[model samples]
Target: MKRREALEKKKSIEELIKNANDPLKDHLNSLPCSYRHYNRNGLSVYLESGIGSNLSSFKKQYIQKLLKVNMEAAYGPKEWVFEEKVKRKEMVAPDARYVFVREIVDNEDGMQPPGDSFVGFLQYRFVLEEEMPVAYVYELQLEQCVQGKGLGKFLMQLVERIAYEYRMSAVMLTVQKGNVFAMDFYVSQLRFVVSSNSPSRMGFNTSYEILYKAVDCEAKEK
Candidate 1:
């Protein structure tokens, strides 16, 4: 009986080791890092820090401004921005696109989604004042210093995987047509198709193009 008990303990320890070796499990064990809960005032503050003199170009310029700030801060630590003082000129008119933090949840169909379960981070969405599918991510940011650590791609994949699980036709966003880095990243790396002839929305005249990735692809082996 003592021998059997020792074997059971060994088995439990082996199971733990196996779980610890999993990449996702390892990340979760190490995470909840660099997350913030930005409310309206907080979101406003976060945006103001990045973009100056917000104009009402787009209906929800505030949300777009936030995305711009988050993106720039995450990826834009160049000398030219400071030297040329181009940061001030980058501000857009304030509009109604807002951000929120709800929760990250795995759907019944086995897709992980943020903002549905309680992850305590900001999620920016562009929604018309009168629309049903109001939750649309214009741009997603995972903090500046932590950008290249694979977490950004992981979070995006999480969103894509969840959207696919729910049978979403496509996931969409507008990109600054001149943002070659963003265009290349989405179009080449992630396989999103660019819409060549989409109608431009009001006040969003800064070289915008609609891009989308199909969510319903054949399941790949895990």
Candidate 2:
């Protein structure tokens, strides 16, 4: 679908909110997959379950479902987008890891879902890109109601933080050029640079752009 048409049909799920819900992380602790926490820019979030290769069947299905929901919500009826690839990677890739993100509710003084409330999720793995190890973000999707909030930045920060923690050189991700919103979000908002090896950059008319942020060594030096 064209970018203009996609923007026209776009609707935020926040329209369904009956009461005010802050799109930031909750203040609870010790939830499932809670590996790290962040308080940058007055926004808080947690890293849960640094699972490797052995993601449960239930989690795999849920991630696929969420991915489909996000894709359809963005570009209309993307029924064939995310499933087989997610399954194959999550079930077998030795370096694959899942990072589930949740929005915390301060009023309840507890987590929203199994650990915290489920607002969004991310999947990534360590891989060699251009002869250097980097954390590659396979997917990052958040609920519509939480879109404009700072949570997306927080999640990307998590990916970079993980990369630095593991001594990886950077964090990489793929975004469709047709996805104007995401392209802007990643480039303008998150400050990711397109890789020189990306398809379009290499003169091929491609659907996506490979973007990366240098982390680890550079991050630690400063």
Candidate 3:
């Protein structure tokens, strides 16, 4: 409990990212250096770490746009309004952390690319679930162009790796039941199971389901 509390109180997850020997860092380094593009040799895609509170205005807008584009349908009109407001508040929370997938132009000058280069992002935070320390993924939004390319799976894998590195009990996320693709991807492909704290498990009817992948059994036991 003490260890979990300490981790929850941490201001940043950068220590793990900066550790030279951390497997999470190694895994990130092993991703494809370039994504194939039509004109250039290849567009470079890289992961960047950020805190929600520190996000630039442009990035904040981009995140909002991505969330709306990807989730509005699943949430529907009535629910979307409330959900959007909630998500906007969550996005700027002090503890929220992000892993952004960004594309770089294949140019000699290495200038900042246009907003379209922002492919996707994963937002998460450390929290206690059922008295156990866990990493809760609030959002994982990918652009349509990047869909079906295994990037979502890769991001989830990174989340699990991060959880293991931090000795978290599990990596948890919520998915709307209406989103069949997301449901299949997480439950079937990623092997996430319905969490005990989920509304369904508790005999409640809800639009979303909570799912989790246990990362450290020993940590959970402790």
Candidate 4:
């Protein structure tokens, strides 16, 4: 896309997001069905989204298992896994307005329960931090069975589009330093830069890197 066209497109999407009924509502409308399917390494994988507050107990359990399985190698302590979910339950409440993503598998006829075949999830929120609004990614995880198939990139593109549409100048996330693949994926493929205030840059030398990709020139480096 040309620079001028891209800027106009972002402006148009921003207007839609600002005028829509809910926060960034047009972004979801653009998606229509909460579900979409794509081919990954010849396997059809479905990605779906919904109001986080609407997730059922079973769905929550599915998220728990997927997160534990996908992240335990990097995060450690299965008990912390459970604890994190406990805190997440608070995040998914209605007013927090989180958008949740889950991967579903299709049956022979393409019909299945929403909670039955969940392979993973991504949780996100749009809000002002330090006086700047940004699309903050809380979590993005996929089952080991279907990972490394470009699905993460697919989902991230969706997130970036939404961020741009919502007029957020930056798309921000945190990556564990131990997760080398994730680091390379964000920095190399997605072109994310480490924020000036990131843990390592600030001398905390933490295990996490706060990364962001500027959607426009006005985006803060931090």
Q: Rank the candidates by TM-score, best first.
A: 3, 4, 2, 1
Task: List the lowest-lDDT window of 10 residues for candidate 3.
Answer: 34-43
The lDDT of each candidate is 0.40, 0.63, 0.75, 0.68
**lDDT (Cα, tens digit) per residue for candidate 3, span 47-152:** 7767777889988999999999988888789989999999999999867878888776656766545555789998988777765667889999988877777778
Candidate 4 ranges with C-alpha deviation above 4 Å: 1-26, 31-35, 78-87, 95-115, 220-222
Pairs that clash in candidate 4: none
TM-score of each: 0.39, 0.68, 0.78, 0.76
lDDT by residue for model 2 (1-222), tens: 697764543322122111111122221222324445544555455556545456667666667677767775554444345644555456446555666766554666564334536666777766666655667888887877767767778778766765665556778898877789899999998888888779878899877789988885643232
Rank candidates, lDDT, best first: 3, 4, 2, 1
What are the root-mean-square deviations of the candidates from the true structure over C-alphas? 19.8, 15.2, 6.2, 6.6
The residue ranges of model 2 lying beyond 4 angstroms of the native Cα positions read 1-46, 73-92, 105-116, 216-222
Q: Kindly report the root-mean-square deviation of model 3 from the true structure over all alpha carbons.
A: 6.2
In model 3, state the lDDT of residue 191: 93
- Higher-lDDT candidate among 3 and 4? 3
Q: State the lDDT of candidate 1 residue by residue for 67-105, as single tens digits.
A: 456555434558435622443333232321222333333
